[model samples]
Target: MIDNEPHKTKAYIAGVNLNDPNFDYYMTELANLTEANNMEVVGQSRQNTEQIVAGTYFGLGKINEIKSMAHGLKAKVLVLNDELSPVQIRNLEKLTKLRVIDRTELILEIFANRAKTKQAKLQVQLARLQYELPRLHPSENSLDQQRGNGGSTGGGFANRGAGESKLEMNRRTIDKQISAIKKELKKVANQEDIKSKRRNKKQIPKVALVGYTNAGKSTTMNGLLKEFTDESSDKEVFVKNMLFATLDTSVRRIDLNKNFSFILSDTVGFISKLPHNLVESFKATLQEAKDADLLINVVDASDPNMIQMIRTTQSVLREIGIKNIPMITAYNKADKTDRNYPQIEGNDILYSATDEKSIKLLAKLITKRVFANYKKFNLLLPLSDGKTLAYLHEHAQVMKESYENDGVHAEVRLAPENQERFKKYLV
Candidate 1:
């Protein structure tokens, strides 16, 4: 028998730091991203500089040193900490004799590998193509043929002389693919919009969970779903202890009690220096957060770089055009820290998502923030007006109900909009 397991590439990570306070944290993230892409991080290097080198990312001497070190470590790939210019990537690869991959490309590769759904696959593909469009070179005119043949050359001298025309053809093909993907994405988004409108008609508030990748957003979602939702495997989203574990958005109606119900969504997690193209492509998936009434910004309280991670999430949210929405800073993973679990600070909470009591407290906090405008109302509907009564049952929190000779009497908690709509039947 022959063994046929694919070999993992050995990657050496490096970055040029311009005295950034978060330089080490960023390099750590680069290494993690490398591992997430199924590459083994065999070595690392960093250089402090006043500014990045324009032609080559690192100083010539630094590059030479990195080349020697990587050679010694048997590294086959050089992963940089920041997005590099096309010229820089080419120069570095020529000087070091190793494949050069920038931060943006690495992140995109991880996303491409992790995408499971058609929407996610299309989104990642769009971002990857956009990243490559600007980096195309005249010498790489065979790119279209290579991609068309599934990422491999046909092992012949065919089309060895074609130049400008081939590049133009490749560009046009990519442009056409981009347009087709956008059209398909629009169709999927329209379907989602219809469902969202249905949820909107129910008059329930929406809350979205967002945070740094692997900072426990999916775990938190599972915890809430397990405790509040009827036990069903399909109701739970996938939970894993890895970066970018959840790529698709998952929405579930969480009924906290007979008197409380709101829509909860778990969105794709954010990361520092996320590629702009990726964000643009994911806009449809992230619309849930954009339309949310409240956002729970989950943080890993146990991580030493928690503050930086929080800032990264906030920056990404702003880039995604989410502004002025109410948010609660949920410092999760309290069990990993020494602080008491389920502790509440103003506009923030320190809690473990896996704890039942902590989940209950989180639910209460969400209800308080999302339902702040709801008010109690006493109403009487005519016995024949069964439609209105049924509407109330579906949309409002019915505190009390009874049948009377004159009509059906009930006390309910209604949102501000609902309160006005049912004013005619008020007691």
Candidate 2:
């Protein structure tokens, strides 16, 4: 921690591999992350090396240059946009005389602040421990003192009645902590299983909002919910603007119309270059997307890389084992687009989410998509049998209704599974 209350400090990027096209984007996101954490970027340095030094990540010349720059700017923090090995971290700290952190640590810190639910906090702690385990290499400064005194080959304590490496003990401790965290998560997963079973029994059609981070997903959700419910009573609908905003799943019951309605679920956002381990840990949270009946893959219309973001979103979806779900692309932020947006493959629907016409079109498109799979039915019920008519109207979308001499005649479209409920009136 800085002695002076963490003033926004200048920093720069180092150890960049230029062969990868995504390197620039990753560095840009790193800048964004730093800004999010209340830091300022004074400069950035890039290198074309494939293998970083085992000690200092940058070459000795580059390290000396960095040292001078840090002293010149009085930079308190050196943010490396890549995961540095423990030795590299130690070397950088000694050379720069500043707190050195990698992308993993930076992300975990952001997660630490954003985590709201019990499960999210646990997962963040797990990731943090895993990251800190390696970097927490016991003070070699003390180890050097022990070595100077000729206590053992290495500076620190030993194991099994013999001098063992300090690194070995640290590794063992990390392994133990990882196992314990996994056990705790297993218990949480069991509770999730029970909750999922209950939701299945209710058989409510689920629509999940999924997209890349900072892609206005939460904004879209707030707009959609605000359109459906009055502002005073829509307190349950939560909206936030941050990386991984909406970490915990928020389920809202939306009334599509008088006859058909379903639940809309907003979930955690995805990011480019998201660590595989983090993705694995967030599987349970992402199960909401997997179980959704339909996915509104929200895209930022103004972003130039909408196609790449869409691909990344789909890749994450497939990683979580969700395929074959009907999807509608919700091209959000259309009002901000310079010109009218072009269409994408697979049932694309364009809307600003802030526009009244756009939101109505979205609702209509959702209804049409859901009803496309429904089986058409024409039934005539006796006038005396009010129970059956009410049941039909409640369970299925009754497109047309006519009063008949016998009772009422209704033409409706309903899912094949729901058709069984009205078998008695079929004629």
Candidate 3:
């Protein structure tokens, strides 16, 4: 049967394996990324070589082979698994007669398209500018022509040749834009820091949802929101069956109970081989996870590549400098498999986000883990000291409070720090 779908850019993907065991998984992720970017992958190939060619990414014979195969499949673009230099990209474009896109460029394009908010847009722009700063050609016509033989040596704005002039002008423009964006981002980050300080003053136990993209982190967050938060149902973070459906960080207060109340944040998901520029640009957006008291690494239980996905998340977490923090491996989408609805195995849980009971169990597990060290304390504050009374509610879980002639008595559960700070009020 002749099948037909809407017009999409047909792309051919290829990679060179340098004897790495994870090469195949990288290619699989590349294909998924291509599809996520609204491109149809028509063919794929790999060359087993110990070293990469400096000029052209692939050997002469392999390039010709891939060119013929891509042409036969009517592919209009060639995608590679690794980032390519300007020289390699230009050389391959000349040899294959097809537009060439490296992994970094492809990921950046997707991020640029998905960005919606001002901060996310600025971050993607910053990363794109940094990526393009080094890859700019002297002119549209020629990839070479002595683009100033590297950086400035002694030339001033008064004198420059025509080609050098244009190249230098473009570089300066991008540099200025990069500096401006960084300034704006710093302002945004300062605002975020102020808000973070307020949350810290309250001493709420903060939990962050983090995992691989399209692994249902948002869905899990929505489940918790629907069950706990007072916000309208529509206030949930964006959810779609696609990679990077949401790029912004969302923090909401989850009051599961008076004792279990805490702050929950949903952050951008991770992917294997994520670009370093993108990571550096998004560090501020990912600040929630860094400050989290606990992390939930949601995994797709039904995916055949489950193990690889878990490993990828771990690798990305380490790359981002998150360590020594408590984490739970939540195996989501268990309903897709023939397993039970919800079950906990030590720090890991097999559950489905759509199931109400599963959400409750997961919440209970989190509550247990977050508050295990909390201890009950009895305190008596003078009736005139309303300030400490109010602080008690925010800093600790106040279980009971009563006013008498001389003072106010209260029962509360406090963390170690809170307990030490309030020891003077113990009765």
Q: CA RMSD for every model? A: 3.8, 5.8, 4.4
lDDT of 1: 0.90
Off by over 4 Å in 1: 1-7, 141-161, 382-410, 417-421
lDDT by residue (tens digit), candidate 3, 205-267: 999999999999999999999988777486688899999998989998898977678888998
Q: Is candidate 2 or candidate 3 better by TM-score?
A: 3
lDDT of 2 by residue, 319-353 (tens): 77889999998888877876563333357776786
* Top-TM-score structure, candidate number: 3
Per-model TM values vs. the true structure: 0.91, 0.79, 0.92
lDDT values of the candidates? 0.90, 0.74, 0.90
Q: Write the per-residue lDDT of candidate 1 for residues 1-91, one digit (tens) a residue.
A: 7769678999999999999999999998999999999999999999998999999989999999999999999999999999999999999
Give the lowest summed-lDDT range of ten residues in model 2. Answer: 155-164
Candidate 3: residue 194 Cα off by (Å): 1.7
Which regions of candidate 3 deviate over 4 angstroms?
1-6, 141-160, 384-394, 402-404
Q: Give the count of colliding residue pairs in each prediction.
A: 0, 3, 0
Q: Pairing residues by index, what is the TM-score of model 3?
A: 0.92
